[model samples]
Target: MSRTKLHLLVPLAALGALVFASLSYAQATVGTFYQQETFTGIESEFVCQPSPIGVVTNTVTESGHFVITDQGVHIRGTAIQDYRIDFADGTYLLSVSPSHFERTATSSVEVFTEAQQDRGTLYSADGQVIGIVSVFTLTHITWRDSNGNGVPDPGEFTSEVSQFRVTCP
Candidate 1:
């Protein structure tokens, strides 16, 4: 090839490599609390994760009082859960539950990745859309309720999960 062409290609190749490396480095695994709720003096735990692979166990606990009224009951119980966050890539994983509960509860997994462009969309293995996670930005994580309990519907549980922000490590 001509020297001019070779020179042009050299920079382009380097740029491509840098872009790929950045994308890989930007990949992160983190956890966040989406919602939380309590009923009859019992409180539920909130958990989140960017991926399910190789996640460390974590737990959180909170103790508070609850009030019951004729119209509705107000419960203030403690929340405890475990979580791990990947600050280098903006990924997280978390396992949350109530410290008072004797039985173990099931948890869900969710991930959000940066979009290639503004019009980009994210899809799961089953072709269902989760959400769009971008670089340097917080993406909404989600979990599915394995149980068929009508109280905690499938897809996303907001009552027991509290929202959290992903910070850099």
Candidate 2:
């Protein structure tokens, strides 16, 4: 897949984790709760040729609050991540991102939204800045389960809005 597509998947994976966690409260406990977590690992897919093709150490810290009512669940959260790609030559590229997300799910409808900004810096083996980059994205989606099957069919799912921007020099 293309790098842009791959980048989108990273946030989706994080969203999946939050959704899975909400499953435990399927009973619809009526209250507001908070959650925080930190994840660190090597994400090889984030690396590319000409810059780095090896391991990329990634760290993400996320925090959020969810409200469960008789009708449905609503969640809002924020995440900050840092990525470091190391090459065999000892050079590295560092990327940092801050993002916000919201999700609402009920019997008949669901909504998911996110906004993110990322900054990247290419550093020489000696820690000097060689280049810089910036990117921003906003996305929103809605689904109406007309059949009540809890699945977003082709006609039921709608990508209401999406915007992406890049700034580099």
Candidate 3:
């Protein structure tokens, strides 16, 4: 090859490599590590109580499995939670219950924000979307006193707020 042609080819090859590297960095995969979070919320019969007696505190602390493919990111797992009054009346209300959840989205940041964008959305350091986040309603809830008792009855309240999040480390 001629000297001028050789120089031009070398520059072109280097430019192509740089562009390829940038694109590769921008893309995501299933990931080597799992993104995890702990979900907790309060359920009560009374409107809002600073003290506890009839109020139930629920928590779900479990790791979820996630996969990011060409189509989108998908997450699936069973979250188990325990409830308790932790107050005078709720000592016996703590027990583990499981809820199965799974979601598929175009990006890691889109899953949690799709239905409740105002509540949960994750952003990158440079303002790019990096993950999904926030507290949300996991299921329909009922909180009526079945026996017509003024105080909250056992198992009388079971409404939960859950949060699912994912961010690349």
Candidate 4:
């Protein structure tokens, strides 16, 4: 995974990267660090067939912490992202998603896990509730240094779990 892409998935990467850089030289030390921030932005996402493309105004509140120990680096965090999505038809969806994510890394292996759920009501241009929307996603990954070179070569990683579900009407 690209470290640069981390910001796209979650805001935790910015702080995590800084901490990881400093820890590269002090693997023997043990310490814990924490961070919290709120961010807002606009983006685009695919909703459903009726309104496949939607413009999203989002506000995300996140908190994360990381621990650097003799064994490895461990990080975990929680985020709540509130979104207001508008479509060309003047319909909209208001959603709030709460998610949890964690990562653990050692010399030989790395693990990542994430879970998120979103529930919302889709409204028409007249402000009447037209539908209900629910979405869930869960993902887990494990990467091992099979050759013991500490490099993540192909076939050394596995996506143990990856699931996404959406319900709408």
What TM-score does structure 4 among the candidates reach?
0.75
Query: Would you estimate the TM-scores of all the predictions?
Result: 0.23, 0.70, 0.36, 0.75
Residue-level lDDT tens digits of model 2 in 27-110:
543333333334344445433335435566666666666666556667777766777777667777788788888888777988
RMSD of 4: 4.6
lDDT of 3: 0.37
Our tally of clashes for model 3 stands at 1
lDDT of 1 at 4: 12
By the lDDT metric, which is better: model 2 or model 4? 4
* Residue range 1-169, candidate 1, lDDT tens digits: 0001221233333333344444454542221212332222111221222442332333333333322222221222333433332222234322232322111122232222111111122344454544543222212333445564423455454333323333211
Winner by TM-score between candidate 4 and candidate 3: 4
The list of candidate 3 runs beyond 4 A from truth reads 1-28, 31-42, 45-53, 86-91, 107-169
For residues 3-108, what per-residue lDDT tens digits would candidate 3 score against the true structure? 0122223333343344344445665444222222333444443212233335445554444455554544555554444444333432223334444445443411
User: Can you write out model 4's per-residue Cα lDDT over 84-136, one digit (the tens) per residue?
Assistant: 87888998888888788888877788898888888888899899998888889
Model 1 has a clash total of 34
Q: Which residue ranges in model 1 land beyond 4 Å of their true spot?
A: 1-52, 82-164
RMSD of each candidate relative to the true structure: 25.8, 5.7, 24.2, 4.6
Candidate 3 or 1, higher TM-score: 3
